[model samples]
Target: MWSRALRSNLKLSKSEACIFFKNKIRGASTCVEGEPEGPVVKTDIPGPKSKQLLQELGSLQQVGTIQLFANYDKSIGNYLVDADDNILLDTYTQISSLPLGYNHPELLKVFNDQHNMKCLINRPALGVFPGEDWPKRLNGILSEISPKLPNITTMMCGSCSNENAFKNIFIAYQRKKRGDVDFSEEEKSSCVLNQPPGAPKLSIMSFKNAFHGRTLGSLSTTHSKYIHKIDIPSFDWPIATFPQYKYPLEDNQRENEEQDKKCLSEVEELFEKYEKKGIPVAGIIVEPIQSEGGDNEASPQFFQQLQKIAKKNNAYLLIDEVQTGGGCTGKFWCHEHFNLETPPDIVTFSKKMQLGGYFHTAEMTPRQPARVFNTWMGDPGKLIILQTVLRVIKEQKLLDNVLHTGTLLKIGLLELEKEFCYLLNSTRGRGTFLAVNATDSKLRDEILTKLKAKGIQSGGCGSNSVRLRPALIFQEHHANIFLDKFRQVLKEIN
Candidate 1:
């Protein structure tokens, strides 16, 4: 069914089909090396030059978490060169943000074009004074991606995109309940003091181990780390469990389905409980893959059912695609694979999109202006880059590359899991956005650290999972390098 849908949607004729099949069989992308010929390590990662800059930056603000300073000019394609001239294969790609790796000629062309300079220099308060080309740019985005949501609200980043999306949902929820009625004087006056009746008690339901963002409104929905929330006050929003699967997935299919049912039940119950508490949930926010919390995945059935629960309770559904957007997942939007009954009410995206914001349903658009206003709602300069990035993805067919490369990664990891059975398990993810869990947190950290020392940069999430957030240009050759380094580390540990 999925393949048929893909074929139907793709609509390839005989010649197109022949080329795609030929590429698939030959692994055409694997033949093209995107990374530099060799990674060079001239000095320790944070050697002298980076340490000096860290000290200077530390004098201004806290710089404890600073890594080696990068020489962006020297970095090319998938390899990152540090200030000390240590070139490492970068898999994290600036927290999974860079779409085309470093210094792609197409992206560089943007800087060379003088006409785009005006939008970059004279930035406007987009809500009130959008540039003349704003609508045209937005039209391009809508036509290209859209995610089945006809409306859009551009914001500044992941958190604010989700934050403002929540506001849009809340306003639509309220407006549906109170049609043709003006705001009462008492309601307007009381809202100034942040009390109920005027402010109205409403909530957004999020799942356990989710990381929405650090901003106040988004923080209320982020449940991953206590450090991000300990000192800050937050809303008493309903938190449901995201399904935890036992691997190998085929062996644990029945158990995983049961886990899905158990979680979906809790979601329905929470909606009722919150309503009884006088703060009904106005929307549901979730990550397609629970990234940051450890690349946790749920069955497509789980997401489909969860959407039904949201609709049943009249809560808008918002998929937080902050970390999963772009072509890393072999699709422009990861949710495209789910075959959702309908498009989500809102899909918030950032990181690789080059701009942060959301595609939402027309119903979610606010009736009044300034309800979702912000200075520089989104940057036009970023949109210019995004437009270019979209062109590169299509012209190069990067999504096909992701699919081929991802299979190489998944198969290699499965083989590693079999060999290193005692140390790791639960290797999972869609496309190149993959991960494997260590037996324990300490072991996970140790393996990650060792991989870094071996000239491969990786990232960790949750307690025991090592995540792969490679650039869209990550070819199978890069995957083989990572797996080779990874196997060496595992062998040494054993």
Candidate 2:
């Protein structure tokens, strides 16, 4: 019965699907032709199925953060269906990871090709034994979404992407130290014992409230939440301040500039202090727009200046775009907005890109093999999905949609801020990678809860920010629904 309904919901007719790639922009109707006109809240948020499943799952493992269980098959287009069958306009988009909403027809058909099916089932140990078409698959990703960086090292997830990028940076730094000399036996021997010279006391500079990932090495750089980092011992690396720009940025121009200056100065000071203290900073990893940290954005000048600083300090700069990349900011890589003199030493990505990897310069390439090696470097199946996703993005002109849709969402947010000045503030972000701060953390969570009840799924970042991370295919009509629902929720909150 659901399949019958789902079939009707999928605007999978060849004509409707092909409407965008050829003629003028056709909007999201072509993407999910039979998608719901608006969200349908069938139950009270977590409803019955969600609560029951949560309880059942809770008995097995930790499910503290499990807000609701999703019925992925039933989910379509921009809507997510919870276990209770309540449909939500999923602005959160599986933590900003889903490029297209659930079950895009093009993607669903990918496995129809036997070769693609074989690739899906026969997962290879990519590092040791990649399939014949691996290089082509990799090159496809590069050609389609290259950050202008020369090489890429694929890994398992966002954490490992940054983790291995850190290794690459360290290896490069060490190679520079080695110059023409070969590694001494003592260096090798001491490294085995986790001692100096080989396993040197190097550090990566990260920002306060920045979230790179949760793996040990990457976790050290993640300062978004105490919950993610507490209990586990972490590296004592430098944590510089990310600029907290005042909202109504036009009104706070001078102050924001000063904020950037102060933050940059501290970054410089950290480099000097760390260098003198013996634990030299090998790399600097920062998110383009700190998503989990509350959608904090810095000036292009700040990034440009930071890049220069990385060069000055002989440290590699890594732009962590796990959340901000994949055309969310109307660019393939969010760092493109910075307009740096040259590409940064490395750019790490995952989440929405279908795989975790870092696009890097040749200098960062480890001379030694297995330094960044793992059993399965990255899933080939994901590459297949990614290739299709990239094609759809190009054919449908999702970037253009993002730019236009983002403009509408931003304008609406500004208007809402005006009307609910006391309840909301600090409206900012790029594209649909947007967020707004409520009066306090309680209010922020309340806004998310209310939004969910209203059949819109929003996420909260920082202490008081309600983040909007709609899918790439999200259009003006979706934005209107979100804006309307948001206004309704705000009125009720007031």
Candidate 3:
């Protein structure tokens, strides 16, 4: 019945419906017209061509992270084509960066406009000199996707966005303390020398398993992995514990509530501890769902209480939505699901948004010019692409599609968890940004390898969780493909 409904909604014929269900549908769907019927594996993932290219590129640079060389030109929606002509269903979607997927027709045609072409060719130092249309473009974007924050400061990428957002928060924190007073001479001179009163020992509190960024300041707050911080001189900042809830949350409500209380208590203690140490926390940065650290999630009640705590301490809350934004979570932002009493002080974004930046409250906007300035603050070309992406998202009601497909996917995963009992568990997440855990990291890696061999390109996070970061256009059929492939992988492992 559901399959029939899907066919009716998508307007697929009998043969087309069969292919869609069987995970083989050649260019027949309207949503992603040129997308392949399903993944086609012609060779081993790092096939002959990719291996040779990796060897060639390895000579000039460290290529440890290069998994496989891709042929973007041949790639289509929900599918990535490798240099060896193997087509794989790309659930990770370039680490959750691709919004509409590879070679999206609308995105490809965006540069066809002479104005957009000029925006790409004549990139300006946006801080110093912006085109006349820059303000108009920004206004359109703000109107369409501002998260209710009035001000936005665009930047280069996720790292810099978080880095600069920390600065903004610190500036606001100090400005509130200064109370319209001009900077004193000592503050100016001391800051020049990186001393007290100028470069005050302010800090941004982050969670234990958080992955904000790798810039000098943001790196100090990042605690996900040792390699990201090894040998780097980091500030002495307070690290709070993020809530670690047990799986099947409904069945573990009391335990999860206690976990939230425990984590929140840690946060309050750290606030006081930092205050007493003379290095007050200016802000708290967190991911709605800790993407890189793990697909760890906290309850909406936890976020509401955390926001209240931030208000009580006068420290701003900065939600890092770099990976969880852009309608993947069945909403424009994952934090929206939390329904906080008030909006976060700053909401940093990038990933699917094309350009990186933060939506900040009026107070968070620095009073002094150039306080958070940078050359080429953001690219107009990227904004042009983003505008099209947003349009497509709304026109197709992709958010609704995400919710529907996510329900089916999650249900399928839960069933698999029951069937594969020992091998899989802890299925969690919203929309298509879902994840399931294996027994251990080794088994997780093995599962991912087997899935990829079956032409499903997925990713792992934290230690043993397989995360799904499919494009927003991912539909019911796509979810079926992944579930089918995943079930096969589990069977093999068993």
RMSD, each candidate, Å? 3.7, 7.2, 5.0
- lDDT against the true structure, per candidate, is 0.87, 0.87, 0.90
Worst 10 residues of 3 by lDDT: 19-28
- TM-score against truth, every candidate: 0.94, 0.94, 0.94
Candidate 3 per-residue C-alpha lDDT over 349-436 given as tens digits, one digit per residue, 9 for 90 to 100: 9989999999999998877789999889989999999999999999877776776677678879989999998998899998788999
Ranking by lDDT: 3, 2, 1
TM-score (C-alpha) between model 2 and the true structure: 0.94
lDDT of 1 at 45: 63
Model 1 Cα displacement at 298 (Å)? 0.7
Per-residue lDDT of candidate 2, residues 1-494 (tens digit)? 64343223331234422332232354344566668888998899788988999899999999988889899889998989888889889899989999988889899999999999999899999988899999988888787778888799998899999999999998999889889578999899999999987899999999999999999999999999999988999988999999999977778989999999999999999999998999999999999999898899998999999999999989999999999999988778888878999998899989898899989998988777888999889999898898989999998888877766776688799899999999999888876788999999998888889888899998998889999888998988889999999999999989
TM-score of 1: 0.94
Candidate 3 lDDT at 123 equals 96
Candidate 3: list runs displaced more than 4 Å.
Answer: 1-29
- Regions of model 2 farther than 4 Å from truth: 1-29
Q: Count the backbone clashes (under 3 Å) in each candidate.
A: 0, 0, 1
